[model samples]
Target chain A: MQTNISVDLGGTNVRCALVDENGTILSIVKGSSNPEKGAQAIVDKIESLIKQLDNYEQANAIGIVVPGLIDQEKGIITAANNLPKLIDYPLKKQLEQDLGKPVILANDVKAAAYGEAISGAGKEHAIVYYISISTGIGGAAVIDQKLLSGFHGFAGEVGNVIVDPHYEAIGIMNAGAAEALGSGTAIIRIGKEKLGQQIEHAGNVFDLAKQNQKEAQEIVEQMTDHLSTLLSTIALVIDPSIIILGGGVMKGKDVFLEALDQKFHAKIFDAMRDIRIEEAQLEEPGIVGAAMLAQQSVSH
Target chain B: MQTNISVDLGGTNVRCALVDENGTILSIVKGSSNPEKGAQAIVDKIESLIKQLDNYEQANAIGIVVPGLIDQEKGIITAANNLPKLIDYPLKKQLEQDLGKPVILANDVKAAAYGEAISGAGKEHAIVYYISISTGIGGAAVIDQKLLSGFHGFAGEVGNVIVDPHYEAIGIMNAGAAEALGSGTAIIRIGKEKLGQQIEHAGNVFDLAKQNQKEAQEIVEQMTDHLSTLLSTIALVIDPSIIILGGGVMKGKDVFLEALDQKFHAKIFDAMRDIRIEEAQLEEPGIVGAAMLAQQSVSH
Candidate 1:
């Protein structure tokens, strides 16, 4: 239940906060990140954010989560697609040295999963599988309140899992990857293609579907089916007690969450149908989860 | 390096062995099982086989592995398609009460995975993923030499994973599950349908492919592709250091294993291309792995 400092670094901004055991954000600061300026600049901005925080000296440790893969053993960001310039950067060492405190680095999505497993919808569960359905889908698992990061930090990399072998992805991922089929980016792209109009985002497509737009509804249904398949595939691998769905796309949960859960249950084996599918309940899970990561590292 | 007793109960036979810490089979026995007679009969068969082993009283513990889903917490067989009447049967308590020894029960495939991780093909690795491609396709994982049996014991149920959502399965599995497409049964079924001839088994299909029969080769290629997809899917979830391919289907490894490995690498991320795909090395991994599982429970 100790207070910890957390920094959630993403493409748009670097969000810093003082999160306690209850996942409460006591104080927060946000700074725009020009990742194009390289890792040092990002580090400077983080220090500035820390300087702006109240009671920063009282925090136990600092945890930073980047939106990409990390070589956890070395505490380096191995890949950050949105922050392309920072790949292979040693973020943990720099932060711990600069801030003069223990530092823990993790993937943003994985941090959120830990937050959910400990303080949100999955708090009561021993095994929680979390999927973030945003601009791109990502997933991670928290087992017995510990993040199960694999040797190469590729554990719970569900985004690249193929749901359909026949469909080809435009990028390095497999054709019909869940990220390519069910993510907000995919929904937006499919919406514009099918509706023959500029669909603003995944929410707009859902709105169109709510208004009885056939094409938009079909697109949403397809995404739901693909996501269900992705969920079942995850169940096939590790049948966690609960699966939490989070991310920006969850804003439209009312439109498809129930149906998506149903489809998922229908697809899995009868015994596994008991696995719960729930929405993530934490407001700022990423920052809070990063704080938990700090707590874990400090205690360990 | 204690010697433990292991019972690997499959449909055709109940194999028992005294396995040492190094996965060496010091003594062994196999008994034909009349699974149709029910759960009690199977337990009696196991006891009779154990009686046949030399120096049985010297073993540290006993481990039983069934080729189906087990309710680990309750030590009961939840489901076993091959041994249908044994579902919901408490095999562990029964064996413990009868033999006056601590009994550990596990899925046969998972036991094999643990066997590989500790002393078989994947002995040198910390994380090992094992897939059995026989009449059906099944998978299991051993992480840090510990079997990661999920809450529902469905941690490695890869057979039901859908590879092609568009294809329909003849049974309860998803339309295009890996088992439905890549398994030995699938090869025989596809071969018979496409070749307009009686296909004895998976090996015959491979033999035809080796003889330059275009249709048979196509079937083999398609099965290999499905299995590759299955392997990539496993890597996407838990990027294990080594993946061990086992089961009856591996008998045709000379024909398709190299190509299947290549296809699997081709489908995964560049960073993960280092994951080794190899064949199972142990002569009887299931019995050996069960002994390992028994050792784990006893030590813990």
Candidate 2:
């Protein structure tokens, strides 16, 4: 019945919680991370947030989940846009010193995938693939409740998977990357092209599409095709039992879910047509999955 | 020094081999399989080929690799065009009863991937992805010496992954499938359209391209671009340590390997730029991999 400390480290905020074996948050604390200040400051904030939790001392291990390329074996964040200073930072060693506890570090999307595989929509399946479509795209695969951390810890980085050969490049990803064609950021950017000075967020695009706007619908249809292609590519390679979709993009999914599913079914190979794509069920999968990682790390 | 019985069931022939623990073929036999004669006849030929092997009886177990959608768990060949009658045939159980030994069945591509993973180019790596570009395209992923049999045992069926939106459909696969644009079959079809006559094989197109023929080079370039997209998509999802390429297409690899590598590098994500793409090292990976599967089944 050992408890665990889980930390969800994001650019905007950090949430620290004491979690039980059942993955329930016993005592939680949240604070602004302001990672732009530097990696050391973020570590200080995480430490201060952990102190605010009542059962912090009882936690046997800690798991930190962050967005970036994490060198899990060495417990370092190699590259992160939000926490740019985290590049090559020994966050695990630094936090372990301040907390006096063993720590496990993993990619945020991978942690959430583990959470879903263990106790969420994918609990009954042997393999689970998770995709998060938000301002940025993220993905992870969980096999038998263990995350598939590929060599170099870069497996399931599907956001950069190209789905269209005709799309424009965005950020560090190449042209036609799923993130460039299907992500919320992509939707907002394209929506602005259709409705200049009127479109705001992805929601505005979806709202117009829901109201039967032709230009908005066309953009959404293209997004659906891109997402379908990405998922179809994933289906061909991994053929997971289930694929769970989450992130801010899911908020507007109602407008395109049916069409997306149809497009996916149309493109997927007959042998792989059965993979179920569902919404992620956990409220705080990143936090809970991190605790799951900490709990599982006891054996590792 | 336990030996294993390995059988490679192909469209026109059956190859049976007595393989040692190190995957060395000690005794080999080959015979016609005339799959058109149906599943029972094909199995009978395989049994005959096994009997011809000098160490057949001494082999502890047997593995049969076939070109089809195999139900590894249920020991059935659920679907196959080469051996059409194998659909839903109890291949493993029937063969086990006929040969008086435990039997293992797997897709030919997956078996070859296991072969490569265990004793070939992938021996030193934790994750190996194998792709065979022949008349058709086939692929498989081996993680930690185990084949990643997806939910439906259809994982690594990358031929059907769409890489273009403008290309016409070639078969059951959707428009723009990798097989439709990059396979040997596809090359022959497109070559005919350019040459205004019959083309024998993919090598002809490559030969013309090597001579700096404009029409031939255009087709080859398109093929390279399609392959690059497919590989880039795979890198984003699986992020394997290395990818092994084989099949008849590799026979002309010298002509296009450099261009393919360049296109892949240009499109692949920066984080995954290090994953190596190499040629398959084993001369007969299908036969060797079947033996490996047989040896692995004993432990299972």
Give the top-scoring candidate (TM-score): 2
The docking category that best describes candidate 2 is medium
In terms of lDDT, which candidate is strongest? 1
Model 2 chain B worst lDDT run, 10 consecutive residues: B265-274
What DockQ, between 0 and 1, does each candidate earn? 0.77, 0.76
Per-residue lDDT for B19-108 in model 1, tens only?
A: 888889998888888899998999999998898888788788999888887877788887787889888888889989998888988888
lDDT of each: 0.87, 0.86
Query: With candidate 2 superimposed using the best TM-score fit, by how many Å does residue A2's alpha carbon deviate from the native?
Result: 3.6
Error of 2 at A121 (Å): 1.4
RMSD of each: 2.1, 1.9
CAPRI docking class of candidate 1: medium
Q: Write the per-residue lDDT of candidate 2 for residues A1-300, one digit (tens) a residue.
A: 678999989889898998888877788888999888888898989999999888788888999988877888788988777888788888889988988999999788889888888878898999788999998887888876778888778788788887777867877787888898899999999999887768889999999999999999999999998899888888888889898998989999799988888888888766666788899999988888999899899866
Worst 10 residues of 1 chain A by lDDT: A164-173
